[model samples]
Target chain A: MRKNNLKGWLYLLPAMLFLGAFMVYPLIDVFVYSFEEGYNFASQTYFDIGFYNFSYVLHDTYFLQALKNTFLMVVITVPVSTGIALLISVGLSAVKPLRNLFQTIYFLPYVTNTLAVGLVFMILFKKTAYSDGLVNLLIHWFGGASVDFIEGPYWAKMFVMCFYIIWVVMPFKILLLTSAIASVDRNYYNAARVDGTSAFRIFRKITLPMISPTIFYLVITGFIGAFKEYSDAVALFGTDLNAAGMNTIVGYVYDMLYGDSGGYPSYASAAAIILFVIVLTITCINLLISRKLTRGFS
Target chain B: MNTSSQTNYEQISKTSARQKRAVHVLVYTGLALWAVMVLFPFYWMLLTSVKSYSAYNGERFPRFYTLSPTLQNYADAFTTVPLGRYLLNTLIFTAATTALMMLVIILAAFAFARLKFKGRNAVFTLFLSLMMIPNELVVITNFATITNLSLRNTFTGLILPSVTSVFYIYLLKENFAQVPDTLYYAAKVDGTSDLKYLFKVMAPICKPTLVTIGILKIIECWNAYVWPRLITDDENYYLVSNGIQEIRENGFGRENIPAMMAAVVVISVPLLALFLLFRDKIMTGVSRSGTKG
Candidate 1:
């Protein structure tokens, strides 16, 4: 028993070292920095600080806007994408030759850089009608005027990002759910058919119950991704657009790092900590829900 | 009853034939249209990459898709910037990280799935639970930590922070558990060492899953824009994604859509190649994980 235990530790040592150097050290540093003011945006110096940074960022108007945007993004994206992906997965499962092709297409977006992909969408959705952009061209052909997508305050910008997020992230949720979806025994469906039950009824009675755990997984993952993601705002419109959009807390951190920043990065650290806490709480809630749902996932 | 049965059979057969045709068309239309959407931007990129500056700048639709297409963008792309260096840097970082990750993740997964260790569950659970934390959140202090170490803008600073992957560990563990224990028992009975057994027995069984993870790691590392951007400031450390973004911002003209599109095509082609190569492994892994193969 002692030898076996020793062997196990030997096996685990490499992984532990890797995590210790990277994950644990960085985490500790973040906590440490949260209590201090970073110095010299140009020279990039670190200095001492009290709780003033936290208090300032807490009271800032931008903090509130970031909170609102982050939560709003989560509230919209999680259930919407998970539900739609499930529908698309189910719809495609009915086809044979096209199944692999559809899966590849669905998944291709996930592999591409989200920011680069977002740029493509920006080009497609430019304000002008029929001048090289896709959506505008379509609108012009339909005798409708082009709409300025990014110029609208906050919501339109948020919605544009959300639209792309849903389109892009759908593949991941579908991929996982497809895993759970395939596990449902075909015999149950055969039996249901013998009893004259319709496909919809069989799906409700058989499919939904089995895949609840996967659905729950998607719920939490989608929410977590939504909350922390918006670094792409910098990629899309650079610092100026992100500051105006108010769509993500992460973007706020980037803005504070590079923008006027008011000489207080300790506040950004505080914001990061709070975002971490909220996301962690959501994760805990998800764990509980997953445990409950997965009882029947068997 | 007999006369009504014949009528019902006739009606049902006709309806079924029409429905089958409709389903075929639906399948074709839906799949084909999305496929087009998926490939059109790519098509545009491929075409634009060959267009000269004058032709690309022209507002009128270039009379033909391939009218006197040139390879100058490809040439200019390499010559105008340090594209080769960035590509080399990305390749090196990706290769190193993937190798280390595979070794670390595979062993840990084996220990968790196969061996009996003290605090085994505890360690694995700690790793799994932390999977929820956005990797971006860690960058705040990671920047500070690297700065303190005087490793900023270095490849070590960029790649070291991401070497630990809970997701890959979890995935490997899940797949490893499915490998039959009888293999282990048989190997032990044959007086083979645990290392040999792992290499000779479990490794082959888990190859597809590992390939899937490898493909995933390549994709993530290749597209890792934010992390690399945050970690490295020097042009020497630029990954393809970040390199492309910088090109857009400071390198190219906004009206130079063709050149911009060319860059997209170039960045994407390797990924496309890798995906095509591993397409079979991807499906197999999915099927084993209960998704379609």
Candidate 2:
């Protein structure tokens, strides 16, 4: 037993060290650093600012807008993406032939470079001087006026980003939910059918109840993911993450820390901490709510 | 009376069969539509990559298909940017990070799964809780640490922070735990050392999960845009994703769009091939990770 314990410790040492240095240390350092005001990255100089940094970030128009945009993304994306995924998985579960082919097609989006595809969408949605782009061409084919997608109003940009998130995230959710739907006992369906249960009723009661846990899982994780939206925004709008009026919190923080306009690492740290707190609070709330749903299932 | 009842049963069966066929048709149509929607952007990307330069940015309306297709854009992609070099860097980073992650995760997972250790459960629980903390929160301090260590622009800076994945460790641990204890002791009775047992018996038993994690990690590295962008200042160290982003941002003219698209296409092709070949494993791996979370 003693020898086994020693061996285990030896095995765990590297991982502990790595996580300690990278994760635990950074977490504490950032929390501490978030309190400093006007801290210079080069000079490594700072004075204790208490909650002033948080207050400043809260009051700042850009940061507040970013906070709102991030929340909007989470609110709009989680349900829309998860809902679409649920519907698709239901359709997919009914089919047997060419199922894998369709899945592979859908999953290609998840595997493709998000930034690269965001760039493609950027170009596809752009309205050129000579002609509306591909999307517009299709609209024109139907005798409808072209809609400005990228350079349009704030809500239009938000719509585009939300559309991108939904499209990209649908595959994973569908994959999960399809498997979830598949794993539910076949006998239940047989029993329901024997009683002459209508198809929609069978799905609504049996299928939905059985797959409620998976849906809950998707919603919670999807909510957390939306808050961290950064690269897609960058890919679509370049460094000009601001379009119309929307900017993601992560993108705003990135500009502060790494953008060419010089960085205030300390302020960025505070913003990140704020983002962290928001994520934590939301996760806790989700867990609290999900406990009720999962308990009923159990 | 019996013959009439039999005819009624036959009529009901025939109607139900027709209904089933109708249901199948609806399912297929819906899936097909979504699949087309999913594939349309990729098709457009490929189409745009091959369009003649004039068609790409001409005064004429955007054409869906070009009368003439050319590889000039692909050629320009290579010429204008060190795409091949960026690809090589990304490949190196992917391989290196995946190898390091596997080595660390395997050993740690084996320890957590099989070994009798003090505070083992406590340590494992701590790691699990760490997973809840979004990585974005730590990027600030991590950036500072890397800069302080003077690791910026180096592959070590890119690989080191991400070398040990807590999630992969947990997945492998779950896989390792499923291995029966009797086999492990039997190997011990046969004079197998712990490391030998792990390599010879444990690893093979968990081969599928390991492969899944390996592929996912590779894809993660391939799609990695943020950390690589932050760490590497020099173009030589730029990963393919960020490299294309930089080109799209910095390239001066509207005419460069095709070349940029070509670059995106080149970077994306290998991943598409990988996905096609290992579709089942990738999907299973993802779903497994999701449920575990």
- RMSD, every candidate, angstroms: 4.7, 2.8
For model 1, the superposed segments whose C-alpha errors exceed 4 Å read: A1-7, A35-52, A127-132, A150-156, A194-206, A239-247, A257-265, A283-298, B1-33, B60-68, B110-121, B173-205, B283-293
The C-alpha local distance difference test score for the whole of candidate 1 amounts to 0.71
- TM-score, per-candidate, Cα-based: 0.84, 0.94
Please name the candidate that would achieve the greatest TM-score relative to the true structure.
2
Candidate 1 interface RMSD, angstroms, 1 decimal: 4.4
Report the alpha-carbon TM-score of model 2 versus the true structure.
Answer: 0.94
For model 1, name the residue pairs that clash: A179-B290, A179-B291
* Candidate 2 residue pairs that clash: none
DockQ values per model: 0.35, 0.61
